[model samples]
Target: MSAPDRQSSFGIFQALRIRQHLVVMAIAFAAFALQAWLFQHRLDAPVPPILTDFNDYHVVGRMVAAGRAIETYDWPTLKLEQIVQTRNWSFMPWAYPPPFTMLVGLLGLLPIWAAYLLFMAVTWLLFYAAMVRLAGRATIPALFVILPSLIINGKGGQAGFLSAAFIGWFLVFLRERSAKAGWPLGAMIFKPHLAAGIGLLALIERRWGAMVRAVVLIAASFAVATLVLGVEIWPAFQKGTSTASEYLWTGFYPLERMLTVFAALHRFGVPAVAAMVVHLTCAAALVLAVALAWWRKARTETVFALTVCVCLMTSPYTYDYDGVALGLAYAMVLPRFVARAGRYELPIAVLLSWIATSNYLWSGLRQYWYGVPIITHEMQLWTISPIALAALGALVIVVLRRPARPDAPWLRAYSWMAGRKPG
Candidate 1:
């Protein structure tokens, strides 16, 4: 083809890609809108959620209004029972301290439908903004936000985007300067499980100021909850956590067993005390791994990637939609991986990305449990459950053992071709 003809074709292709992207974005928003409407109108229809889980936000909103605390034994009887009986505004109880409950409550002030809209939009924007910041470019921001796992979070009304943004910001802050790390790290405590892996990273780096800031922020949030809701809420929340595993076990969700270091032992009939010991030991070892990695000045993005793996490896209930964070981390690091290692690593990256987001769906379907939503099954195993935990653990081990020298290109190539990276 002539040069002008080739240029014309390339321009047309670029235009088509842009149009396709916008169409997808519109469809995503429309899906969220439709889901929100269904949730508002037919929450009692007995049909399960499609690809997301947003019940927690609704429950928390109501609990805040009624000034009720989450109860240990009364898991299934939250607001649904009352709504089923009387169609009243009564909602299920919350399981968090007042600060968290209040935050959701504040979000709830806008009608639930409105809250859902705002949640989707804000999360999408924050996720994109943070990704752009991480990549030092806006080129793939929309692509990052529209990822399947992320859309799942938006569907369920979960705060995965918020978690991603905070974690990304924390990483960016640390990279920019150790001094400013404390504030963003503090913001992270809002979703404790999501931040747990990164917190260990902070501790490993010995950023005392960051550690202090995190502690202070946590204390402040708790203090605010106590003051606003009463001291009874903390004890109530603790009780809720203590008994959460029991309720989960009774549920049909996959990996009802505590699947992390803490829950893994518990699942195998380990005694509670022994399980706690194992959990603490594993947690400590993870912290040490991150600290060692930091000491060696591993790449900044690697720290974030490993932090994500830590979540999978350690958290008790890492859900599949929460795996969106893993995807985000991968997006940030993939370019660097490709730039350093090239096409050899491409296939592994594709496979890992697929499993990271959809493994649960495929696993569940393969088991012939077609009755359940693919996203739900995905939540069970693809999230932070054992399979994900195993995958992430293996990834981290690879990261730690891989060659560190620049001249060791062969080792890097081998590792990449082998489809391994630091978590």
Candidate 2:
């Protein structure tokens, strides 16, 4: 073909791709609109219940704002505090550490409904914007790719988006090999366990600068928490953890809502001790695999994708909303996923996403199911733990035939990528 002919052909291809993505973005916007509708007009009750994790957050915020911060750990007092919003419905004991209490306490500055909407909306924006900064040219298509996870998170008032934003920016900084990578990890101190992968990656790669900064930020969080809530809040937080664990163990908290390896095994009738042991074993293996992947210098996209899965698998208490990170993981590897050049790619991608995101996020659905020996709930079975392992394995196979290249230009905005102009 002549040079002019080739240039014209390429222009046409670009136009078609842009058109496709625009179509996808439209569908994503529609889905988000539907989610807002559901949140506003509750079908199950005249109003959305305070049964979500937000109840604990709202009540604790009220306590802290009302100078009853210490009573947040005291259930009798906390339950009475919840009566204002949660009423006589079930209460979710505060399971977070003191640092997170500061965040929840800020929510008390507004009414419960207002706080719920604002918190969810802000975190949702954070997650989307953080991912877009990394997604770059593919931002439009990526929106639809992660739509289900976004819908699930916005449907309820949970911290899923906060965690997703952390993971998203953490990857964005890591792609640039910047010290800022650790800053996000430090901010995740409220749910530090979910950040296991980043810590492991830093140690394996000898990223001392990033690690040190992360430690400093963590210490700062503790200092701020102490300054705001007082040193005694630490002991109260410790006691609260015990109470929360007991409640989860005694079945006051639904095991079916938990998406951990232990929860899956326990649902299938495994003893709690045995299930926990298996979960720990799986987590340890994931750490080793992710470390090895980084050590051998696999593609950064592959390694980071694996790391996202590793983080979820290692976190024992991550719930459905937390699946947002899993969706982000899929987006990271989109250009390189299996069947990339075949007609099956998009369909296969959607299937994998559904398996990762699940379908039990809505309310009023049957919460229980029976299958002879496997009397279990819907999403509680696939468990983010096993699903993460599955994703890790699938990623490895997809890249098995391709030469390992330490390249990830799709993760744009890395200052190094575009001549290091320093964005």
Candidate 3:
């Protein structure tokens, strides 16, 4: 075939690919719209489950705004049952720190319903904007609409969307504007566990400026919160933390609802101590992986993706919505995955995508399928952790096999730090 013939055929293929992507995006958006509408109407229910988590934030926010921050943490004196009855809201222990309470208090200024919608909308927008900036416009469908985590987060009114958005932008700016990256890293203080792995990775990479800025920002946030809410809030939070930890271990929170290594093990009838040991071991391994990747000067994008995955793996408390960060990680490495499409990579990608979106489907099946319930309730949430672990393993393999581009800036920086000549 002539060169012109080959070029024309390639152009046709590209156009076809674009059209296919557009079609998939259209379907996803339509599905999301329907879900949103159903959530709003709640059918026959007076209150939709979408407000479950948000109500906690809204109530706590109102309490903080009304100078009742201390009461939020003082479970015994707070009379949570009475408060719930008065407010007509669900019971949710206020486990977050004072800094988070301050932010929530601002949202409390609005009506609960309006605050819930606005919070979700704002976080979704931030997530989309960060994703577009990092992965480009073509990747929006996969990260924003198709990912089941976003849907879980939207419905649950969880902080996962906001956390994922912060982490996504942090990764985007980490290499080029290291100091500026601190802002998003600091913002992730609301869910400190989610940011723990990345924090360690930053330390390993000797990103001192970013680390220092993040520390200062976080400290300032806490300090400001203390000044506004009073120092007693910290001790109250500490007590709440202890209570929360006990609740987690005693199975007060259903194992079927938690998507963590510890919960997965416990669901299988492992002793609580043994499950915790396994969980800690896995968390350590994930941290080590990130440290090793940083030491080896792996590609910045690859390291960032790994950091996100490791964060989820290590976190003691993770729900389906928290997988939004995992989706962002997948989006980060997607361009490279496309460039070097392997036989196994496509299948793995498809499998992980399905797993990310399977929480609700799995729950429904467990509830309605008699056989499923007979098998085990733990299987509902346990299924997510293994798939995520496998995906992380696959990601690590890909990163190790793919050498850094010689001219990548991070490679040069690493070389200088190690006293080696930049190749």
Q: Pick the candidate with the highest TM-score.
A: 2
Question: How do the predictions measure up, each by TM-score?
Answer: 0.71, 0.79, 0.78
- Please give the lDDT score at residue 43 for candidate 3: 24
Q: By descending lDDT, how would the candidates be arranged?
A: 3, 2, 1
Tens digits of per-residue lDDT, candidate 1, 9-41, equal 666655654564466568868887886786666
TM-score of 3: 0.78
The residue pairs found clashing in candidate 3 are none
Q: State the C-alpha lDDT per candidate.
A: 0.58, 0.67, 0.67
Per-residue lDDT of 176 in model 3? 71
- Model 1 segments beyond 4 Å from truth? 1-28, 44-52, 69-94, 137-146, 178-180, 248-253, 256-286, 340-345, 363-423
Ranking by TM-score: 2, 3, 1
Off by over 4 Å in 3: 1-51, 75-91, 141-146, 339-348, 369-384, 395-423
lDDT of 1 at 106: 66
Give the lDDT of residue 417 in candidate 2: 22
Model 2 / residue 199 / CA error / Å: 1.2
